[model samples]
Target: MTAGNNGTNPPEGDDPFGYLYRSENGAPSAQGQQANSPRRSYNEVRAVGDRRYGQQQRPQPDQSPSPYYAAPETQPGGGQGGSGGPGRRAAGRANQEPARRNGLLIGALAVVGAVILGVGAAFAFSDSDDDKAGADPGASESADAGQDDAPDPDDGPPEEDEERPLPQENGSSLRLENGPVVAGDVEGSRAKDGSYIHGFKEGSAALWQPEIEEDGEYTVFVGYTVPGKDMSLQVSANDASPYSARFSNYAGAEEGDWAKGWTQTFAWVELKKGTNDIRIACGDKAEQCSVAMDRIWLEKGHVKK
Candidate 1:
């Protein structure tokens, strides 16, 4: 205080500015202290710079953007960053969750539908096989039923209004002819020339065998021609007792024109299973006995046992 402090001075108490000084001499003033102070290190200066500029020292190129500083805002649930708006993250999750769920549901439905279709196809194939397996038996049963219901084929010949004669050949023996034979041993018999006869026989007879297992009705037809003679013919089987009838009355041939054709109708006869002989005899010993017999034929009828 005497002549005005010149170079340095000391504070009165422990001064707040003491941290900036060294105790090398009396307390230096502001300008003198600055000249004597040590220089700051590069690291220290860089740290201070970083703090002031809000930057890091040598930040890596690959470093992620800071959540608080990069872009507009960050998602609340830690997804892609977006505008700093309310419910941004929630809205993102809401949009994506339904798609994921829908995908999952679709996948599940596809699997379920595939299983259902597979099961249905298996069932259909099984049903088809079952139907195929059963069809054979059904068809066989139907065939058997049809066979049982069908009519027997052993029925007799059909009926006709007019009786027809069977044609005879040279091989047929035991033929009956009218009197006055054309060129046989009996040509000059008691009958007139070319007249009819009564008891006529042939040189050969036809053989017949019956089916005994299936007994049935049979009809025998005998064809004859007569001339002006009302005659009756009798037929006997195996030389048994004869059954006689006047064919003139039955065939409506009684008009006395005997040269016309005549037919003898007989009842249905049952045949046995052996050889049989059929014999014909004339009924009347009348005038000019002359007749011609053609042939005999057998026919089977219904009513089989």
Candidate 2:
């Protein structure tokens, strides 16, 4: 057998362990330097590290990109780069001037538009006033003439009422008996000038009775607002006795003053001289009105209408 057939020892000048670990570029290391040529050993090829290697290390190329491998930096203003100085700020202001002027111009236009609108409105108002003044000379006079009367403004705007003569004082008087059915409104009505009783709800009224010493024929005047076209009062004297007497409104009373009227609405009835009750019911009509009497005059003789 030949020596090549047995693999007991390595080839001439070769190391079986050193074949695994070698240095790159065959550079001299820091350890095991020669005396004459200053030779270095493989242990000092690189810096020592904290390593735990079960297998032998093999040589490999460096893969990191540290500063040692980077290219040198070039100065600016040589290629695509420019000198970034105060000129950049000047260019920015030059680009913004048009926008600033546009803003100022828009503000001035708005102020001018507002002034024009105010002047137009004032002129329009003045023209309309002039036209109205020239149109009707007696417009105010006509409005006053349309009224039922032109009473002194001091007398508190003549009451809203039908045209009627003013009130006159009554001649004779009687012991006025305030009725029991008098509610608070009736007292309030009594408080009103020329208004005695007030019946605010339907089917309600103020009652009254007079003691007559000697009764033959009497004149009665009722004061109240204008009666409805067909509004009739349901009244009775002494136990609901049928007394269908047509009572006329005390003229201006219907005109709305305390509704006091001096007109006569009388009836001829013979009495035995006792409690002659008078119930003037305004309830059959609207709560507003039917009949009210501020004063009553029962004279000696039968008075005509």
Candidate 3:
């Protein structure tokens, strides 16, 4: 009914928690208890965390004041005249240690990241340099130094691949056999003497001995004239198996006009680097033998050139 107990005992169960309210009946407050009061005996008016609970009370050593709940200005020598007590200093140091560790960790991570970036930048620069070198014309030339030189645009296109220079032979150099004759009657001969081998037919042959520079495949070209019809002859080299060498009617000349019927045809052959003998004969297998031979030559590959 009142704010305080007026220094008197309260009624039983009147308010066991009455001390929590304003005490208008004048009972001393929980904070106003003196050193010898009954409230001080039970330590009820002490700070919340001042004593340990659920433990036996024993003689305790004197220790520094707690930093918790203590004001910086109220601790011994903590005012403007002093920095702080040892307790405040210790708590300040403890609080700052985690921040210092975090700062150090962040700085280390930044340094590591910078190193990684530097390495990556170095690799990128190296790759860029390689690419630039690859695109450089001088570098390309050096890389291809062991290969064949490229054709110069001003010098004209590169010549086709040939192992050796072609060799030419005149019809007069051939040894006529079996009704063949070397005469000047046909006027379209490319020989120096304007002569050609003629009258070659079935069972006839013209053999020539020519020199070769290399051992490989070659093309044998025959310059001849046909009277308006396709003709062929049997050819053999080194006494090997004979094969047919066809000569087409490329001149379009009428019958009996050998001057207008001069043309060339070719066949592939194999020869070694030395003297080789070639024979053109109208053998039994020949499709036609009515062709006048004027020249025979060799090219350096399997295809006509």
Model number with the top lDDT: 3
Candidate 2: misplaced stretches above 4 Å?
1-195, 227-231, 247-264, 283-289, 300-302
Candidate 2 Cα lDDT to native: 0.46
In order of lDDT, best first, we have: 3, 1, 2
RMSD (CA, angstroms), candidate 3 = 19.6
TM-score of candidate 2 against the unseen true structure: 0.30
Instruction: Rate residue 149 of model 3 by lDDT.
Output: 66
Better of 1 and 3 by lDDT: 3
lDDT, residue 182, model 2 = 25
Residue-level lDDT tens digits of model 1 in 23-110: 5676654534443345344345444224421123454678765676654544355454445544566787779999999999999999
lDDT of 2 at 39: 32
- Each model's RMSD to truth, in Å? 12.5, 26.9, 19.6
TM-score per model over all chains: 0.43, 0.30, 0.45
- Backbone clashes under 3 angstroms, per model: 17, 2, 6
Residue pairs in clash, model 3: 3-23, 3-24, 4-23, 4-24, 4-25, 6-25
lDDT string for model 3 (69-165, tens) is 6577766666532346676677778899999999999999999999999999999998898898985758967868846566667998776686555
Over 4 Å off in model 1, which ranges? 1-95, 115-221, 232-234, 239-261, 267-271, 281-289, 294-305
lDDT of each: 0.48, 0.46, 0.75
